[model samples]
Target: MERIELVKSIEANAERILEDFTEILQYLRSEGSDRCDEVQNLLFATRRMVDLIDSALEIYHYLIRLKYLTADTQRSETAESRDRDKMLEEMFRELNSNLGV
Candidate 1:
């Protein structure tokens, strides 16, 4: 599949996961402390899932920015293009940090 298609798919899946997590959280709240241990475990798993989804979304946004920046750079003059190139390098560094790479 194409990159944009993949990003859209990931975003859709992330939205579904967040919706499910909200439903589960509401149910757990209604249940009170009767299943404290199970609730805690589920919360931890939900947190991890959220973190992963957030990372995926961040990367998706980074790709979008990179695409726009590249297009802008291509249309710009030499000095402006150099500045955009620096910006692109900074964006890559930021992305790498976000991915812990």
Candidate 2:
């Protein structure tokens, strides 16, 4: 209900999405690249989406930090950056499994 709590919830959800994205991307590169043009194109699109998301989140975090540091708000939470190269070792639902990995 509070502002901080809402941001925390969003951050938690984003973490899960990031994890899934990383797993799916890795699987595609490892075993799906040679499948066909469709898979390759899809993978490229997904990667671009993820990159954009990361950049946007980073900017969001920076703006938040700036506002709080400038005494604009009492609620200040640092958006801890996730490791870009991290991998999720959990099983992910097959993304168009028939197409490839």
Q: Best candidate per lDDT, number?
A: 1
lDDT of 1 by residue, 1-101 (tens): 45566567667756766776676566455644557866776776677567667756766775776677666666777778789999999999999999999
RMSD of each: 17.3, 28.0
Provide the lDDT at 83 for model 1.
94
- Residues 1-101, candidate 2: write the lDDT tens digits: 44565466567656756775776566555654355865775777587667657755765775566556555343332222222222222223244354566
- The TM-score values for the models, in the order shown, are 0.40, 0.36
Q: Any runs in candidate 2 off by more than 4 Å, and if so which?
A: 1-35, 72-101
Positional deviation of 35 in candidate 2, in angstroms?
Answer: 7.3
Pairs in steric clash, model 2: none
Candidate 1 ranges beyond 4 A from true positions:
1-35, 77-101
